[model samples]
Target: MARIPGRNPWLAWPAGIVCAAVVATLAWLALPMVPVVVAWVGESLRTATSPPVAAPVEPSRAPLLEIAESDDAIDCRRLYPDDLWVELAWRPEALLSQDFSAPSTSVASLTDALAPQVRVTCRWRFDGGGGISSTLARVASDSAAVVEAALQGEGFSCETAGAVLRCRRAQGGAVEEHAVSGDLWLSSVETGRVPEDYGARLAEGLWGAG
Candidate 1:
């Protein structure tokens, strides 16, 4: 055959085969890291796309003694003595609801049948225990005798102590009823097991605070 070309076509076949082998080796070496690369890309995308979360908030409640003041319901703290170590226990709205129905004979009859149309009523307890509860009710000055008789019929020894009506027994229970304002009565009861004349001091404190 004549020398048609400087290099034969068969010589070029070896070079082509070697180039194919190198490409195949590189692809086989990189196959194991494919999962790692995919995982890194997924985590980066998640971190960039996710939003930040916020914390929760708390609610506020109005103080029991600082509610709106009116003729019927004055501020409990304003009516409470400052020097006394007693605290406002409950709100008048919770305890002394008014009832126009007939009254009950028993003082403990706080149910609807016995409940009075009290305007403002709140409980205050001493630091150690025994305390007094004060209530404001509507009673005319001319009807003082009627109030006295009612309390006496219930076993309370009521007597006119100056401008106020003092009622109690030697065993411990006591009460103070005074006309704080025209046709407005303030009554305080010192529950059983308190010191002697505690009701008087409480009454004086109420007087000063009011």
Candidate 2:
């Protein structure tokens, strides 16, 4: 038989040493990047799980009038406070004041167009002769413009009192007043022996003294 070559255990040592050096070099290169890789993954997960923020909304304006919507007529007593009625020297018994008919004013056509649900008509008469007819009507913006134009055309003295547009015209003892505030319309016709500040008083009745 041919002599078997002696096993070279020393030759395997160099190969094992080369493999160990390769693994050590790789670990040295990769160790510095470990924290950076962990931080990147954590940031991505946090962003994905976070909730979004919303924008704020604005509030609407408050209404000037406090009257409710109704088809039925509002009682005259409930329109103004008791102290005001007393100050005006108006009798509670003559709330309707049927002795004389409601005055015929230029705004009759405009009043006709208003629905009862949005309109409040009040008449108060004295036992002597003269009385007042006041109408508070909530109208559309377009209708309000028409009413304002009509008053200006009728040669009424117009002025701005805060948010209220007041117009007045007087012929003999009859004094007619018209006021517009936003979508609200007020028309008062006073015939014979009526207060000079009747329109102002009515405004106070609708809003406050202010």
Candidate 3:
């Protein structure tokens, strides 16, 4: 009987060697592009997840000023200089009752200090409840800012004239004016007869014409 033909184990070795060589060649050829592929993938992920840049915002504007560090000693005589009394149309010395008072504290008080104090307060009355009350107060730079902000919040129209900040408001028969210059805060309230250019004259008296 003829012996059955046997398969050759040696023939399988060449196929295996050829397959391994092909795999090694493919791996070597792709090695140079590995870093570039990895970098591209990482960049894509970063761009997708990164937050958008915010728009630039403009800063708010405030009045330019320099406040006094020391307390200002103000009196009615100094605040209402010569000719101002007549300009206000208040009677000379006959019928008007006048009052002037200054702060008792020796130290200067800020406009927004915890224990705020006024430099001086004055009142002139021609008849019962027909008069003007005024005050001069000291302030620091920061406190002056607070004062201006407060006046604006109270619906007072404000404007800057030179280095002074002036604000005014009127309701019924009462008119109010507030002015700031250097380290001084001057305020006046009038009831009954309102004078023409009263606030302007008062500020001019305190700050001396703009």
Candidate 4:
């Protein structure tokens, strides 16, 4: 028989089948990888073209007002306009008196009565409208005594309102009231640590003088 120039039928068919299956699997696996590669390239381009974001700036706060210290109290006179003035004092201890009738002498007489017992004293003065008023408090003393003392300082008549004492002063067109409680000496009107309304009332009472 002549030598057969024949192909190996078994090898040819199996090799072809094997190659086709491998090609199909490779295409299936590469399908998902295509989108990932495209997305990565897009992100890189975006990063190369875009500018960096800037940091935000913050605002600064206002400075606090300064106060001057004296032997008797903290002074805030300079912070306000020349027409307005205020002073405050704090003491560790003082003697207080019972609310009593206004003395026959000057308001200073009331202080003279309590001076024997007061250990510490605090005082504040307010001047405005060409008129000046003062408030004084003696701590660690009886609240009544403090009220009486404040009344005496202001040249006001004294009266008891519940546990507190009130004193009034009348001069020119103004009537001023000093309401004392323990170590607190508040004007009838509020101002500063006190209320503006109270201060107004105080000024009205003092100015009205009626």
Clashing pairs in 1: none
Kindly report the root-mean-square deviation of model 2 from the true structure over all alpha carbons: 12.0
> Candidate 4, residues 1-210: lDDT per residue as tens digits?
564478777788899999999999999989999999999999999999999878887743212111111134322232222223322222112112222223222345444644432222223333332222333334343656755755675666877654456666656555556555444333422222333334434322322211
Residue by residue across 1-210, what tens digits does model 3's lDDT show?
564478555877798899999999999999999999999999999989999888998853221112222344445565664676665545543143334444221113323252335666777666445677777766564455665677777777888887788877887777877777666677777777646777788777656544
lDDT of 4: 0.44
- Per-residue lDDT of 69-126 in model 2, one digit per residue for the tens? 2344555555655565664565433446322233246756555654322355677777
- Whole-model Cα lDDT of every candidate shown, in order: 0.51, 0.65, 0.64, 0.44
The order of the candidates by lDDT, greatest first, is 2, 3, 1, 4
Point out where model 4 deviates above 4 Å.
1-73, 77-106, 116-129, 143-164, 171-174, 186-210
**Which runs in model 3 stand beyond 4 Å of their true positions?**
1-74, 87-115
In angstroms, how far off is 87's CA in candidate 3? Answer: 4.1
What digit string (tens of lDDT, one per residue) describes model 1 on residues 1-210?
776778877988899999999999999999999999999999999989999667776643223223222344554454445544242333232222232222222354322322344655656455445555666555554455655666676676766654556555433444433333234345665654444445555555543222
Residue 134, model 1: lDDT of 62
State model 1's lDDT: 0.51
Model 2 stretches with alpha carbons more than 4 Å out: 1-64, 68-73, 89-104, 112-118
